[model samples]
Target: MKRIPDEVLDHIVEICNDEAALVVLSCASKRLRSRVACRQEAWRKRFERQFLQSNDSEQKWLHQHMRAKRAATHLGDTTSILLFPQGSAQFDWFDAYCERRAVEYRWRHGKYAAHRLTNTANVRPRGVRLQSILCAFDYSPAGDVAVVSQWLIASPRQSAWFSEPLYWGDMDTEDVVVLSKRQSDEYLVIQAWNMLVDCYSLCVWHTAAPHRPPRTIITDKREIPDVSLRGSWLAHRIAHSADTGQYGAAFVYDLARGACYSDIQGNIHTCCSLNATTDRMRIVCVEYNKSTSSPVTIAYKLWQVAPDRAEPMQCQATGRKAMSLKQGDIKLQRIDDGKFILYSRETDDLDPISAPTISLVEVVDEASGVLLKEKWSLGIRVMDIRSIASHDLFSIQQTYDKWLLLSLIDGSEVRRVHFNCWICSGLYPPDDQWAKMIDDSMWWNPRDDPTLHIHEEASQELSPAAIVYGHDDAITVVDYTGCMHRSEHQQGVERLSIEIRNRRIAERKHLVAEDKRIAAKRKLLLPEGVRMRTEGAHLRDKSKRMREEGEHIFTESMRMRDEDSRVYDKGKRMFTESMQMRDEGRRLCDEGRRILDECEHLTAKLQEIRAQIRALDST
Candidate 1:
C-alpha cells in the first residue's frame, strides 16, 4: 500500500466520490491518510461533485459552498429549532444548496392570496386608497411578529384584512414613505405629506414605544425626496421652497446621537436623486443643472459623499463631475462602492409609429464617469428595483407582469416568476391583452383614477430568513417553509428518494458491524489449519458456516449498492428532462415577446393611418 503510485490513489479517490468512503480508505494506511489530508484539490472536487454540475464555474461553486457552510456553522444546533429547519451543519453544503433551491422554487411557483383593502366599485367618503407599500418586516417564520405598510397605515400589528391598526397617522396624508434598518430596529422613521398644511414632516419614532410622540422635522413638500438609512445614520433629500425658486438640499442625521447636519452643508448643491450604500458611510448624489443659454444640453453632477474616516462626525465630498444627458427621467443609486452607481433612466420612442418603451438600466463607474453595462432592458416596463447588498442580487418588477431575481455577478437571471394574477388568468393571449391595456391606460396611477387601483409588489427584507413582498392586502413570504406544501406526487417522490438514501446508509453501517463481529468470533474460536490435527473435521464445518454467512452479507450489500445506483441513474434522467423542458419554455417566452413587439408595431401603424385619413377627409 505504501508503494502505490499517487496517480493510482487519485483515480481511486475520484471514483469513490464519497467522503465517507474516502475516510474509510484513508484509515487503511498512514500513507493514504497523508495523501488525502494534504490534497486540497481532492476536497474541492468532492465538494463540487456533491453539490454542483460540470457546467458550473469551479470558483463560484467553491465560493457558494463555503458561504453555505459558514451560514450553517454559525447557526449551530439551533438551525433545527427554527420554523424552517436547515438540517445539521455537519451534513455538508449539499444540504444547504438543496434548501436554497427549494426556497427559490417555492417563490417561483407558489400561489398568493390577495386581500383587497378598499372597495373598487364604490367610493367611500374618506376616499381611502392603498397608495404604496413603504416598508415591510417579518422577523419570524412562525408569523409571530410582522410589520408592513401601505401609504395609509404603517404598523407592526399582524392583521389579515384592515381590521387592526397600530399607527394610522400617516393614513390621512397625501404621500407617505418609511425608511428603517434591520440591524438596528430601535428607530422607525416615517415621512408624510400634509396637504392641508402644505408641509412635509419626517417623524422618527422608537419601535419599542409606538404610542409615544416622535421626533419630527417639518419642511415644504418636494417632488422626489429620497431617504436612505444604514446602521444609525439617516440621509435624506429635502425640496425647500424659497423666495427665488424651488431648490433641493441633502441632509444627514445621526439617530443615535440626535445630531442633524442641516447647517454644516458643504458641497451637495442640488438633489435630483440620492442613494446611499448599505453601511450609510457613502452616498452618491445626482444633480441636474440647465444653463441659461443652452436649455437643450442639460449637465448632471455626480458627487461622492463620504464621512471623514478619522472623524465620524465630519462629512466630506471629494469626487465631483458633470455630464450631459440627452433624454430620460434619470435615477441614480449607490450599489456597493463609490466607484459604481446603478444608473437607471426611462426613454420612450421618438417616433409615434412605435409603442412607448421604458426601463433602461446600467451600471456606471464613477472613475471615468462612463456607463459600464449596456442598457439591460428594452421595450420592458419596470415598476420597481431592489438590491440585496450581501448577495449582489437585484430583484425587479417588470410591468406588473413578472418578477425577476437577477444576479450582478454573472448577469444571469436567477429566478423569474409570473405574477400570480396573470398566472391565474392562465398567462394566455387575454392576459397579455389586459396587461397591455393596463400599461397604455392610466389605471396604475391612483392619482389619475383611484377607482381602478392596482396593487404593486416590491422586494423587502421582511425577515432574516425570508424575502417578503406585499400586494393589495396580502403579504407574500418567500422561504423554504413552503417546500412541504408541494403537490402530492412531488411529495411522494421526494419521500421515496429520501427513504432510499437512508436505507443505503443504514445497510452500509450494519454490514460493517457484521463483518467486525465475524472477524472477532473467528479469532477467539478457531485455530490455524496446521494446528488443527484431531478436530480438523469440526473446524472445517465451523469455517465453512462462517464463510457462507460472510458471503450472504456481502451479497446483500452488493444488491443494495446496485439498487441505489439504479435510483440515481433514474433521477439523473428525470433531471435531464426537466432541464430540456425549462429550455423549451424559455424559447417559447422569447417567441411570445417577439410576437407582441410585432403586434404593437402593427397597431401603431394602423393608428397612424387612421389619423392620416381623418386629416385628408377634413381638408
Candidate 2:
C-alpha cells in the first residue's frame, strides 16, 4: 500500500468512526498514533455525535435506562450528567447545565424518601437505591441500570437477608416508585421466602414496548449467588469450580428465555468484566486461589450475543492473559478491539489495610494465550477508581501522570472532584494558583449579605475547607464528611476579614486614580476661562459626589471590615478557649499526678505500719 500523506492520514484518523479503526491506525505507526492521539477533541466530538445519533426510540430507551439506573444507584449528582432538582430542605437549589436553562424544582422531604419535582408538571422524582441508605451504589453508562450491595441496616437484629435488593424507576408519568416491595409484618423482609439474593442483578425496564409493564430480568435465582449487570450481560458466579476450587462462571443471561447459563464453572468474580460493544459482548475472568499466595492473572473470553441466538456462543479468547502480578484488588477497563487494561493495586499490610500501589496492565491478543503489557505504575495508593467522563479516567493523585494526578489528588483530598474535572486542561481557574488568584479577585461587603460578612457575633464561621469548581464557573466547598458546607461553616469568618479590607482598599484606590485621570483630561479639553469656571464648579460638584460615593463605599467597607474583624475575633476567641480548655485539662492532670504521688507515699507509710503491726502480733 502506498504510504498515506501525513495530512491525509490525520484527516482519515480524525474522521474514523470506529474505535477499532482509530486503534488500528494508532498502532499502524508511531507518527499516526501521535497524530491521532493529539486530536482528543476530535475524538470527543465524534464520540458525542455518535452518542446522540441513536434513533429516538434508542435515545428514549437509553434515557429511561439512565433515569432508572440513577434512581436505583442513588448515586446523587455525582454520577448524573443531567442535574435534576433535589427538593430536600438540605438540597433545594438547582445547578443548571450548560445548554439547559435553570427551572424551579419543588422538594418534598419525607422520612423514608426525598422527592424533587421539576417546574413542569412532570413528577419524575430522583429515585434512590435502598442500598444507598447503607452501601455504595454503582451505575451503568446509559444510566438505565444500577447495582448496590453490601448494605448495613440499623435494625438491632442483623440477618444476611436484611440486605435490600431494591430497584427504583418511573412507574408512571405521575409517580416514581421503588420496585422492591417491603412486607408489613417484618421491617427488613422482602417476600417471605429467604433466598440468597444477588445484589447486582440486571434490573431493566423495557420502556421501548409501549403499554408494557417494566420487566425486571434477574439472574436465575438458582445458579448465581451474586449477580451484577455489566453493560448488556449479567456477570455472576454460576457455580464453584470443582477443578480449581474457585468460583468458575460465565457472563450468562438468557434475554429471550430470561435465564442464566455457564459452560465452565471457574471462579468468576461479579460484574468486573463485561464490556459492551454495539454488536459483541466481552467477558473478562480472573482465576485466583486464596489458599495459595499466587499472583492473580486475568483472562478474557469474548462472545457475540445476538437477539436470534438462544445461547451466546463463546468466541475464542483473543486477548492475552493480563500481566502476571501478585494478586490484589483488580479493576478492568475495556480499551479497544479485544484489548483490555487492568488496574491492580497491592493489598496493604496495615491492620485495617489501606489501598495499594496502583498499576495499569494492558492485555492484547497473542498466539498462545495473551500478551500482557504493564503500561505504568503509580506511587500513591488508590482507594477507588471512577471514570468521570466516558473515555476519561479519573483517580486520586499519584506519582505517574504528574500534573493530572496532582489536580485529581488535590481536588479529591479537598473533597472537590464532584464539582469539576480539575485534571483536564483548558478548564477555568487553570490550576491551584489560578484558583488562589480568583480568590484574590473580589471583595465582599458584610452589610450587603450576611454570607459575605466577617462579624464575630453576626457572621457564621465557614469551616476550613477548599472550594471546588462546579458545572460552569460555580464553586462549591465540601467538607471532610462529603457534605456541602453550610452557612455555619464560616464560624472562623474573621480570619479573612483583613484580606477583605485590603481588597476593598485596593479597589477604592483604583477608582480614585480613574476619577483623577478623567478630571485631568477634562481640564485639557476645555478653553482657558471656560476651563477655569467649569473646572471649579465641576471639580466641586464632582468632589461632592465623589466624596458622597466614597463615604458610602467607605462606610460599606468599614462595616465589612468590622464584620470581618468580628469573625476573626470569634475564631481567635475559639482558639483561645480551646487553648484555655487544654491548659485547664493539663492543670487537672498535674493535680491528679500530685494526688497519685501523695497516695503512693501514704501507701508506703501504711506498708510500714502493717509491718510493725505484724511484728507486734508475732511477739
Candidate 3:
C-alpha cells in the first residue's frame, strides 16, 4: 500500500530474498519504485545472498546444487543447465553461472544435433564452402554450428574467414596440435603445437575484425610443445635439446600486453608438468645423471613464471635448486596455491640396508622446492592421478580396480568409486572399437540410442556426484555429494515450483512470439532497390510539395513585409507626434513646478498662521 513505508518493504525484501517480490513492490508505488530502482546497495546484498554467500564458488558445487534442486522440484529428469539467457560481460559471476548452468544441462539433459562436415568423398560437401576438416574438433564458447578444426573454423552455414582462409596447405591436421584456445569479446587466441616446426604457435585474432589476418608467433624452440592459457596469459614449456644440455625452460606470455616472460633454465630433461594459476604459472622438470646407472641421481627443477619476476628468455643457465628423488621417472602434480605433489613409483633392488621401496608421494612448495610434509602413503601404490577438481585427485592404485580420490593438500583418501567402464587416455586408440569411433561418421552425436541412454533412473538411491560416459557408452557419474538422486523436501512447495515453471514457460512463449512477429514484419519490408526507389520517389514528391508551399510562403512573406513597412512608417509618424506631445508635457510640467513652488511658499505661511491659530485656541 502507499501508506506502507519503504524501509518496511526493504526489510521484507531482504528477509524474503525474492527478486520477484522486489519487482512487484517496485511497481506498487512511485516512491517504492524510486527506492528499488535507485538503490544499488540493495541489489548488491541480494546478489551476495543468492549467489556468493551460499558456496557457489566452484562449478561442481553449482552443478550438484542445481541438479538436486531440479530433482526436488518433482519435474521430469530433464534438467536444463543454463536456465537463463547468457549475459554478455567478461568475468561476471552471474554470466559465469549462466554459462556453467548451461554446460551442466548439456552434460545431463541436452541432446546432441550432429552436423556432417566432410562428404563421403573425404572432401567438403557440395553446398559447403569450407575446406576439408583436419584432425580433432574443438567447439567455440557458443557451441552452436561452428567447429574449429585445426586451422580452419567451419560452421554449417559457412566457414569463418570466408575471403581468406587461415588454413596452410603444407600444415597437416595431425601436425597442427591445438594446445589451448581462449576466446574473449575482443580477441581469440588459439595456441597450437606447430609439430611441423616443432614449436608452439600463438595465433591471435580479433573477433570484431575477422577480415584481418590473425597475428601469429612461432616459438624459437621446438621443445615447448604444450601450452596452457589462463585468462589473457599463456604458459608454455621450452623443449629440451641434447645439444644445449641444459634443463628445459618455461615461458609465460601475456596475451593482452604481448610480452613474454621466461624462467631460468636448470638441469631439466623435459618439462614434466606445467600449471597456471590466477596470475602465475608453475613449471616442473626432471634432471638425472647420464653416466652412473647405479644410484642414479634424480632431481626435479621447479620454476615459476610470474609477471614481475620472470627471467628473460636469453637469461644465463642458473643452477636450479633440485628436489632429490631416487631411481625412477619423477612426475609433479600441481595443487592449489604454490604447492605440488612430487611422486615416483619404483621397485628398488640396489639399497641393501632398507627394504625395497615400492612407491613414494611427497608434497612440496612449488616455488622453493622445499618439502612441506612427510610423504603420505595409504598402503597401496598409485601409478597416476586423474581428477575433475583441483583439490580432489582421483587415481587407481596398482593393486585396486576401483579409483580413489585423495586430497591434494594432505594426501588423504576422500572416497573410492567403482567404474564398470572407462575410456583410455592417449593419442592412439587402444582397440579397434575406439579406432572405429574415430573413423565413423555419426559416432560423435549425443543422442538417446540404446548405447547412449543412461536408463539409471530406477537406481536413484545411489546419489551420484557426476555422470561420466565411458567407451562402452554406459553412463555413470562419480558419486560423493549425494545429489544425483531424488531429494526429500518439506511439503507444499510443489505448487509453487509448478507455478514458477508455468510463468517461465509463458514468458518464453511470449518472447518467442514477439521475435516471430518482429521477424515476419522485417521479412515483409521492401528489398534494397525497391526501398531506395520508393524513398527517392517519396523525397521527390515531398520536394515538389515543399517547393509549392515555399512559393506560397514567399508570396505571403513579401505581402506581410510590405504591410509591416507601411505600419512601421505610420508608427514612425505617430512616434514623432508623441515625442512633440512628450516635449509639450515636459514644458507644462516645468511651469507646474514653478507654480507648485510658489504655492508651497504660500502654504508655509498658511501653515504658520494655522499653527498660531491652533496656539491661540490652546491658550
- Note each model's CA RMSD in angstroms: 35.3, 30.0, 34.7
lDDT of 1 by residue, 1-619 (tens): 8788988887776677455566777679866764554455556444444333311122222333344444334434244222212332233333333343343334333312223333211112221212112243321111112243221212321112222222444344333333322223345666554545655666665544433455674455553266665546677776544554655667777676666655323323333223344323444444544332211222233433344334443333323322223334335544343223333332322333322232223436467553434333233334555543334445556645556666655445764333332221111122122234322111111111222233354333332223344444444433322222344444455566568767877887899999999989878766664367547878888899999999999999999999999999999999999999999999999999999999999999999999999999999
Write down the TM-score for model 3: 0.40
lDDT (C-alpha) at residue 238 in model 3: 64
Alpha-carbon lDDT, every model: 0.44, 0.39, 0.44
The residue-by-residue lDDT of candidate 2 on 308-414, one tens digit each, is 55655555443333233345445564433333345554333322332224444445556685454555544344444533222223444333442232222222333
**Per-residue lDDT for 480 in model 2?**
19
- After superposition, the stretches of candidate 1 with alpha carbons farther than 4 Å from their true spots are 1-101, 111-164, 168-186, 207-213, 217-224, 240-246, 263-280, 290-328, 342-344, 349-619
Stretches of model 2 off by over 4 angstroms after superposition: 1-233, 239-247, 254-261, 270-274, 277-279, 294-311, 318-329, 333-340, 345-374, 377-380, 388-392, 397-619
Put down candidate 3 lDDT per residue, 153-221, tens digits, no spaces: 222322121122233323344656665555432455665565567666666665433334556755565
